[model samples]
Target: MRNVVIGFLGTQLDMGKRRRWRPTVDLCRTEGFPVDRLELIHDHKFNRLAHSVKRDIEEASPETEVLLHRMDMDDPWDLEEVYTKLFDFASDYGFDEDRERYHIHLTTGTHVGQICWFLLSESRHIPAALIQTGPPRGGDDVGTFDLIDLDLSRYDALQQRFDQQTREYGDLLKGGIKTRNVAYNRLIDRIEQVAGLSDAPILLQGESGTGKSELAQRIYELKLQRRRVKGRLVHVNCATLRGGTANATLFGQRRSFTGQAGTERAGLLREADGGVLFLDEIDALGLEEQALLLHAIEAGQYYPLGSDAEVTSRFQVIAGASGDLSAMVSEGVFRIDLLTRLNLWTFHLPALRDRPEDFEVNLRHELAQAEKTLGIRVGFNSDASEAWLRFASAPGTLWPGNFRDFSGAILRLCTLAPRGRITRAQVVDEIATLERRWRAADTDQNSQLVAKYVNGPVDPFDIPQLANVLHTCQTSATISEAGRRLFAVSREDRKSRNDADRLRKYLAKFDLSWAELNDG
Candidate 1:
């Protein structure tokens, strides 16, 4: 089997052009390289591009069997089916693994063709190269750009370097990816809609814990699916911006100016110039930075740090804020003009407490993720579910930290729990501890004492409230008649109606009755 040169061709119908690698294909032939096969991926928009590429490959190389893989990035992929089809086709054609030559040539159309190429080459431990064709209108070097031939094998020795870089990038995106109450299906719909629109500064408004970053990424991915936006998603957190450091970070400072090593660094905006630029915690950005950002978005231009030349702004800006940016504008803390510009398609993420219906779904998702990541089969029992509901439904039980808090709590419980399964009692104990921490950390200083009391060791003298609760549980003849009660009441209140309500409310919170407790 001669080397099968797999060229993943991406096209843009909106741009009115299809990316053709016939020239690159010819380059391989000129070099006497055995280009045995080709695979073309057309994401929904370009039927003409797909057919054109197929016909061109067939005519150019009679021995090279061209395979067309149809996909819509908006639709959920069946990974198993895709894998089966790909390998099956290769098998039928007797594709030799050793002879697999993958060259990712990005045709002249839209931007996302690069990512499509990345996806194909990453499927196997094979070599790949990326090249740009002429611009959408056609001509040499019109769409031409520098090429990056990725060497995956080098990544093994540079794991720490890449891990550190990726982690730093992810940290900047933390505020955006935080879990919230937005419906998953609705989010997907919004992403697809955003992809079709042109030059809109998207405003993703939500509470502190809502996942705006993930939605921003979804928007980027969906746009890339269109074949127009080609660059990778670059995230920036305005909150973490420091004085005198912001400009240098956004527009790379000259290496010679600071005498730093390595080639000139690219800012997030420049790196994602042709794709999506996610601005998280945009509310935290300084007035000057905000002005610059507005200019970049409105005029499609920016001045690099320590440079007199102006650069074209080719990226789509998606801004995220935790609170009401409009109100901030009114208060003069934020620029009204900038706010108006960014508030193009605003989406307010609801808090988790407002979406009680999503509790079960969120819990199941978190647990499954934990099992997969940690290689553990931890599970919850009926009682644990009841306990979780009690906390999830409580008046002050708002998950301020959102899904992140929930995930952390679950991970701790799974690690601390016994081998069999976690029970309601265990969950209740964890919730109590978590509640205490939240209270202590909150702005209200009065809550500190309450939080301390709940977390501290229980002593009879510490709280008279426990004595009142005991009196109600013990003196209820209805509870006694249901079953033999175990706890002895403090001699404080044997016949208080108010006491009965307290006991009843507590039991109701856990979906249990006084009779059930007495039965135990």
Candidate 2:
């Protein structure tokens, strides 16, 4: 195979002295590694030097063919210009990998030029290996050369640096909270990647208080830090946008349209121009608004309220929804086309109950934040800390409100602490309050589930039992598991152990099936 060497003409080294072997000429003259062709790149001002170096290469290695290419640059140190020119050159160059091997000579260019070459080659825009030449050692005038292949996996330090950077990005997205849940950490990793790499609309689906809004803000901040965006973040709770004002609030309003003397208002989309727009509770947006948003996202232009001219605002959308958008689309409540655009990068944050391992870590984080906000440090005593830990790790501990409830609990504990020290008594009281709140919520939810299934009025005596049974069935993975738990004590005494049959018959009495309960 033929060998092609591409490099810049070293203005000083390739000129003046024969005693010091020129890097470009020596590369061609190097023993055992013969250059079949040399594609010499240089500024038009250095045309004389390029020809001089070319002549020297021809004399030193008669087998090598030297080709001169004049690439003019105002500032050789300007990275953008150098990269653009080099990228263009690479794009136009005919590469034959099967017949010829390409080598990018790194010793002869400016540092900026060298960096551009590395980037182009690493990204495979230039299909070549990098060859770096140094001064001659021993008897060889050709000098020592090192061939560097841009295989990231071969460089452990570089790979490790990339991994560390990804972890840092994940940490930023998590608001510096030390989370230990494996699934949650993986989710953050994926979000970090998407936030940095893509400008397509992102759909965040999760229950209320699961940090969708917070995550969107973190994504905005990350993109801003990376200089992907220049404008400020615009956060809008779609639930607050209602009736006629919803249109004005999102797409701006003209003073003439309102028949008022006030100045025209730039809406959330305009405010987020060149930045990010976080639409929390996006499912609450009216179908008409959703359609307009879809158009704005796709076209980067929209008609504001009472405005004849179209307003342009190029922004990325990060929408948050507590409910299932797909279900809403099926029910004809949400615009399917809008949902399709936002669903390009969909992420579902897990509920706090599903991420129990992260509860304690997040609790500590909340307490620290509270301390900073309240201007007082609060410490949980050993006994108090243990008590809280037990409650957090307990089986079937419902965190229906997710992180909001957890953070609120920590804030309450800190606020109610005496003299910056939370005692066991305070912890006990907080636990009782949380348990009562959870129980009442569970009871109400269970009653609603019962009402949905049963046709006639349920006997007052049977309400509590029916509610408990329904709650257990919904939480359990299968009828067998539900039956085992519901009849734990009574199952052992039975001669025939058919707990599932007993549970099925009981559910039948209420006109409910396990499948129906779960599907609902």
Candidate 3:
């Protein structure tokens, strides 16, 4: 490992305050990991600290590769430019290997360094370890020295999180898992069939946290493998997109245009060409931006920010929204023409309550994952699981947060449980806490009505007009007689719907129906 070349990109003040470079150099000397080079990247803001560290490094290791990359953390380089520079520099120093062997140690000491670190890791899919600066031993007045320790677990944890995210979101890419959901599955299958193998634009409609972005990623990965598209996956959260100096963030902008000096940056779409472009919370985009996106999807082109150069953006476009884009278009909140362009394909991810069966498997997967992440053991036995199911299946469990809520609940139980084995009562207690939280948010009359409906009358025969009779019978056989009588007309016809069709058909629960509500 002494042959390994390490580059340090962080703050000069931070380096001195935390003693980051000294400890690393010491470790290199002690552990036989040769410190071949040292590059202290700093801005004008840290001029004093930069000069000091530069002199110290020269005295400590005269032969070390000392470079002072002068640029503001924010203005220095965007993620793509950083990748371009780092790879170029690495190649210049003969750091290339057939496999992924070149290691870049990004030290986060300032806001800019942290952002670069996050962006590089995300864009390049590179593995990294975090090292925090600590106080010196028996030093007075917050010792100005960096104590560095490798955060090895961060890599594994990030990988596991990424893996779980892929499975959960990847499942939604095509038509999703049919065995887990009939209504949703059929819709997904139909949509996939409609989308065909061509790179048609896809629009996803659902509330926030419903995994719309995940679905978009899944589509990209699947289509890449299926169609063998030779491009990278690019995702952007439209809600967080900003203009101003951040123009280079979403769209490439001129480096010399601003008072700051830097190189021109590349837009995200350009980097993602040939693969997939996922525009998350697309409804948040202004009308003009929406038009630009529409033109890109339709005409396969767009203009980079602060530039007259028209860049061709020919890639699979997938947009997600929390509300009905069609309605927004009609109400003039969104553009109708743009909506038509996106309506070429649409997929709606069902909420948790809408697909109860998925919960059992999803919950199990979540628990297993949580156990692995937290380094704790946890599981549910038959009785405890039954209790959980009862609580989770109860009415008003729309779980607006969907699988995220389930994951949170399981993780909470794991954290609170004794010796890792969570019981049904523990689940119930958590539910009570959750309910309390809901109640706290329920100050208005509508919330009170919801509270009444969820916690009030136990009307066994209460059935919504849309409730399925077969599903009711399957869930509770005691309601079979009532359901048969309630659907007597259909029974007289001597016809029964298939399982998938059954969900759409009406069934009597607690012997209640639209007529009973009318009578009341």
lDDT of each candidate versus the true structure: 0.63, 0.89, 0.61
Candidate 3 positional error at 84, Å? 48
Error of 3 at 88 (Å): 56
Q: Which ten-residue region of model 1 has the weakest summed lDDT?
A: 482-491
lDDT value for model 3: 0.61
Q: RMSD in angstroms, candidate 2?
A: 7.5
lDDT of 2 by residue, 239-261 (tens): 99999788988999898996888
Q: Is candidate 2 or candidate 3 better by lDDT?
A: 2
Instruction: Please provide the root mean square deviation of candidate 3 (C-alpha atoms, Å).
Output: 20.3
Which digits, one per residue and each the tens of the lDDT, describe model 1 over residues 1-520? 4544454443433233454434434433433455566665556676677787667657766777777666544432455444444445444544344756456555532344344445555664334666544432455432333344576556675777866644433333332233344474455345445655565878888777667877687667656655658888889989988797798778665666566686355666677778888999999999898888888888777877766778785888888999678666755679988988888777776666777766776777777777787788988998798778768867778888776678788887777768847788789788888888886655243333333324444444433444343434534456533222333343244455354455566546435466654443
Stretches off by above 4 angstroms in model 3 are 1-179, 191-196, 243-248, 441-520
In model 3, what lDDT does residue 177 have? 40
Best by TM-score: 2
- Rank by lDDT (best first): 2, 1, 3
Please give the clash total of every predicted structure, in order: 6, 0, 11
Candidate 3, 1-520: lDDT as tens digits: 3333344534443464655435334322322334455555556787776676667666766665556665454445466565555445434554334532323444444344446555444454333333333334564433233323234345788778866654554355532443477786676556544444667788898877777776667667666656646698788888777555334566677665565677577787787778788888888877767776677677776777767778886677788999778766755769999888887777787777877767777777778879898998788867888888877877877675676777788899888888878887887898887777655543333433333324444333332322333223433323344455456566556556233233223323334343332222
Model 2 poorest 10 in a row by lDDT:
13-22
